[model samples]
Target: MTQIIRSLDEIAPNYDVLFCDLWGCLHNGVAAFPAAVAALQDFRAQGGRVVLLTNAPRPQQYVAAQLDRMGVPRDAWDAIVSSGDAAQDAMFAGAVGRRVWAIAQPKDEGFFTDIPEEWRDAPPITRVPLDEAEGIVCCGLFDDLTEVPEDYRGRLMLARERGLTLLCANPDVVVDMGEKRLYCAGALAELYEDLGGTSLYFGKPHPPIYDLARRRLGLDDNARILAIGDGIATDIAGAAGEGLDALFITGGLAFDQFGPDVENPDPARLAEWLALRAQDPAYSIGRLR
Candidate 1:
């Protein structure tokens, strides 16, 4: 049974490390949550390490820059492991062909150009038109603010016909960007699979990202780890797959299902919802606090 808790302090001593999600738990795209920030800071002060594990589809440096821009202080967490970092490793290793088609926004262009020092000897990757590409690299939608997955059905169909494998950078289908929900790279990847195309994911709920996170954590396998996030499919599911305890944040994506009080989730409703989904997180909280 999952226990609904009031704050992280109640259970902090049980775990030595935290694999925290970024989007809904720590920040809401626009700004960092003060309570969530403080909770993580407090965890570190107690000698517990915090790793910001995210499916942001950008390298850790860029994600760190984004956090800086979003007012998420550096002291709140110890390290960051991003899906982009994992996917980039695969891409540079030629998991997909050298000449590929890129589906991303201007902000995501850094994913292609900012090759880490480690990948310097790897084959050069060039972005070509869909018709001329050997594989597809999906960082995100070209315009997440104004586009949806269906917008690329025709193009995806052509790629399917060619048997091109799509490398999905982010495996989050949707995210609440403040008050607006936006489609992500995973949405397009899902659509591609639905249309008889192949899509590869290197994000949450996938083994590759988790493997990379463990390495970044630099902890022994025996270290007690907890995963805290609002994404049921990505963060929570990923934690479950990795045999890590999960702290489900109800206030992030599924706030409405827990009744009108966002800070105090309805226990019965939360129980029923988790039962319906067959997810038994170790603990549940309205927010990170």
Candidate 2:
């Protein structure tokens, strides 16, 4: 059974490190959550280290810039890790091929900056049509706010016909952008997979990102790291995969399934829902506060 807590203060002292999620747990797409930021500040004041782990397709510096723009305090976290970093590292290590088709908005080109010039093959990192590419790297949709997974059926089908391997930079299906939900790269990846295409996910619920997080924190395998996030499929499942405890925040993207009141979701129903998804979060809260 999951403990429905009112605040993270109740369990803050139990962990040495906090593997915090950035998008949904700390903020919506537009602004920072004051309470969540304050909670991390207080946790760090007590000597605990907080690391912001995000599935953002860009590197940590890009995410830091966005967080600073949104007024998420610098002192709220000690370090940052992103799925883009993992993907870039994989590309550099020769895990992914060089002739690539990037499927993302123009603003998302930062995700490929780390691919060394010497390592790339001839005609590297093209934004051309999928038919002309050897592999695919999907950071996100060209327009997340206006598009859904259905909007990419034709493109995904074409990619499937070519048998291109896709590398999904972000594993989140959807995220809350203020009050509205925006489709993410994971939704498109899922659609591609359903159409018999192979996809390599780079973020949460995958081993590579967690491995990077653990190394960034300089922690051993047995460290008491607590992962806090709103997504059960990504955050909670990721923590469980890495043998860490997780705290599920209900006020983020999963608010609809929780109940009418986002702040006070029915615990019984939430538990049943988690059970249905085969997720077992050690603790749950309406919000990070």
Candidate 3:
């Protein structure tokens, strides 16, 4: 049974840190949620560390820059841990091999160029044509706004024939960008796996990203950490997998399932929805605030 709470302050004191999601919880991909930002600020004012644990397929620095553009103030979070950072580590270490085919947008070039300080001495990774590649690196769709997973079926089929392992940067199937829903790298990976291709995931709902977040926190294993997000399969599932408390924001991906009102969720409807998904978050809120 999960409890429906009004605000984060109700449970803020119980947690030493928060591993918050970016896309849907803190913002709608266009602007920062004023209440969400304020809640995190208040949490930090009380000495709790807030780490924006996002599944964005780019390094923390790039994500941070995007947050800056979205008006997510610096005081709201202590750090950021992204899927790209984790996948980049595996990539440079030859997890996807040295020569690979990249499925990403022009904005995602930083995934290769911006090497973290510690990884500067790592082996070089080069991007080549699909026919000459040993693996596939899927940062995201070349154009998320206009593309769907099915659009890449032909290319993925070719990669599968070659037995290329796809390294998925973000394991989110879909994310709401303001009023529009966009396909992410995970959607392509899911399609690839359906096509009998091997896909490696490093984001939420997987241990790699959580491990990176824990490393960033630098806290004892027993430290109280709350994971906040709206993605049922990615955020809530990841929190459950990590044995951490989760705060589910109903207004993101599954906003309509909780009844007519977006802010005020119908308890029974919320319960039934969660039950259907087999997810038992510690707390549920209409929004992150």
Worst 10 residues of 2 by lDDT: 118-127
Against the hidden reference, what TM-scores do the models get? 0.99, 0.94, 0.98
Which pairs clash in the backbone of model 2? none
lDDT of each: 0.94, 0.86, 0.93
Can you tell me which runs of candidate 1 are displaced by over 4 Å? none
lDDT score for residue 262 of model 2: 86
Name the candidate, 1 or 2, with the larger lDDT value.
1
User: Worst ten-residue run, lDDT, model 1?
Assistant: 210-219
> In model 3, what is the error at residue 137, expressed in angstroms?
0.3
Alpha-carbon runs more than 4 Å astray in model 2: 114-126
lDDT of 1 by residue, 1-289 (tens): 7899999999999999999999999999999999999999999999999999999999999999999998889999999999999999899988889999999888888889999899998889999999999999999999889999999999999999999999999999999999999999999999999999999999999999888888887788899999999999999899999999999999999989999999999999998999988899999999998
- Per residue, candidate 2 scores C-alpha lDDT tens digits across 9-36 of 8999999899999887998889899999
Q: In candidate 3, residue 74 scores what lDDT?
A: 98
Residue 51, candidate 1: alpha-carbon lDDT: 94
Q: Give the TM-score of candidate 2.
A: 0.94
Q: On residues 44-137, what C-alpha lDDT tens digit does candidate 3 reach at each position?
A: 9999999999999999999999999998899999999999999988888889898999998899999988877787887788999999999999
